[model samples]
Target: MCDLMPAAQPAEKIGKMKKLRRTLSESFSRIGDCQGSDSLIKPLDTIPEDRKVQRTQSGFDPFEKPAGQVKRVHSENNACINAKSSSSGKESPKLRRHSSPSSPTSPKFGKADSYEKLEKLGEGSYATVYKGKSKVNGKLVALKVIRLQEEEGTPFTAIREASLLKGLKHTNIVLLHDIIHTKETLTLVFEYVHTDLCQYMDKHPGGLHPDNVRLFLFQLLRGLSYTHQRYILHRDLKPQNLLISDTGELKLADFGLARAKSVPSHTYSNEVVTLWYRPPDVLLGSTDYSTCLDMWGVGCIFVEMIQGVAAFPGMKDIQDQLERIFLVLGTPSEETWPGVHSLPHFKPDRFTVYSPKKLRQAWNKLGYVDHAEELASRFLQCFPKNRLSAQAALHHEYFSHLPPRLWELPDMSSIFTVPSIKLQPESGDSIQVCSKSKATSNSKH
Candidate 1:
């Protein structure tokens, strides 16, 4: 009877082993049943009865193997699990889904508390300019705070301006010190410049001093040349965008409309540059432009600096602007501009055939300085290709009187650093004061 009892216990043990194996196979079947389970997981009937009794007494999981054999069993189980997960339809519900890398980390070196805004300098369509002082080093800065749109986030203009300014390091280009980004706003920190050319001109209106004009134009060209050499075009070049330091250092600013030109030129938007400073070619509905597009604006600014008034201050539309330009530079024809007839806006009968007037006649102040009219003519060419390049204009006879070393200075060095080169005082008072005096004199007469 004792021997029969032993035999009955073996049958009972085998039945328990079969039940454990079936449970394991059913649990892993969802993960494409572990292929090695048949060999790795053994029935208790195969183990020595004494060892089985010891494992059961130890309270170890029935499905787990000894510690020494545990690693291999888990590895085989993982292989089948991974295979099932790789199939689109067989993904395990227990699999964890990891997220992608987060957006670009915030600037490590710059923070909002680094600068304190003192006063509001100005406001524009998308941003507000404030005069700021650095909390870390006690230096002044111009903080341009651009509001982020709920739907759009950061404006492309701000991104474009920052990316371009980061690579451009020169005495004539505005320096971008740091950028502070937040959930509600994006702030661009810049070296604080006292005033811009437009405000400076308003302070002393009857034309800037010839020496001052020369200095400003030189700096403008210097900056333009640097950008042009790198295939960049400052699509907008107005007096308001040119910042003037207290020491008369002219730095180009507001590059929101600027873009890099490729080797094979592509058509660009024609609706750039203020009407008063826009070039004839662009005003004539021409989209294919180059660095010359900016040269025309440079010429207009040059004339305005010498004359104290916009060269073509059109009060109306594109036609009025073109008419103002034609009145001075004469209406263009195939003889003057080989492609004039092909321009979208050009119509022979639509424009008056006015003979070209000498630049000195239109802006008498150009006649006040030697070589000034000639340089003005070179820039105000009716044909886009005929305009002088910023680099070439820098070497023109109009700038010949400047110190020879001005041409040889390093890219980041200011021309003011040259000995004896300084800003000359203006001869006239502010425009308002001059206007009041003129009105009083006329009333007395």
Candidate 2:
């Protein structure tokens, strides 16, 4: 798996490069919006034109959570990838490079020549990821090569991502190893993970094993809790953004849209998270939000893992997305959500109000598992403030069956470090084999 060719020969290198280029052509297109398997459900039915909700012109949304002031803290224990910024302003994007003595295992700072690109993995609007090997330590790493625009020096998103990631060091979060800056590009070296949750689900469809699902969900919440406690909001939480190691470790990746919630009064862009996983409050034009902005996506992902399909796979625009969510969770009213009438896009007459359905009613798999529906319902609340915090959800009855010592692990320690805690074989193995066999049979024609 390490070397694509038997040995380095000129002809073989050319062949390998050609083959890699071909593979890259057929690989994931959008790095930020990483593509995976097709949705397991049909495209949602579009809303009637008569009931179509009008779009709003609000610049950005606001999240008003009162938290302590962010303080500048330096650590000598370990050095992170790159960049540091003290200001959490929603508009200004400026970060200074910070360096420290990294753990003996990691490299301090890497130049362009420090790593060798092996193959292209994915390409996004701003960056292209390559499967790379570090020349210094001879370790595999993910190289996120971001091209610099002539007009803008360094992309603000890249600056924000680096600044936030530099301060975050957790087992469940993807580790940034080194930063390689060049005149034309900024390459961020990250610990290469085997696959993401989106691709993992594609391999084993029709729902994952109950044990495996539990483990994945636990690790996800563990990661989120760490970030939320630090006042950092991972605005995007889709399965593609979640990296899954071959050892079944889940690490949150792609901090391009993440923000540190230091200023409660600051309003953020409403066009942040992907449409499918976006919360309803944001869709309703409520810019002011809190940490619960991410909790809604957590519920959607939870249901998707259980049912083997998206909870609400809207095909059209924001209104269509809202309709799919409202169809299940019911329409929000003044009684359901206070200040609902004050939002920029809430039109009471435009929507047909229906009572909220139970979580099991929408996702049948939840009914089969004990305490699963209750926990999901806690996260899928229509009101922004009603969603359960990641920290509180970790101690819910749903996770009670897990080992008690799991709660005692350090921030950098994985739950798998505990004895007898590992991912179970996916229950859909038979289905996976059948699908592969069918595909192979069809290919012969």
The numbered model that scores best in TM-score is: 2
TM-score of each: 0.72, 0.74
lDDT score, candidate 1: 0.65
Q: Report the number of backbone clashes for model 1.
A: 0
Q: Which portions of model 2 miss their true places by more than 4 Å?
A: 1-108, 263-266, 429-445
How high a TM-score does candidate 2 get? 0.74
Backbone steric clashes in candidate 2, count = 5
Q: Give the per-residue lDDT digits (tens) of candidate 1, residues 194-313.
A: 666766666677688999999999999999989888777878787867877777888898776776543124446777776667788887888877888888999999998999877886
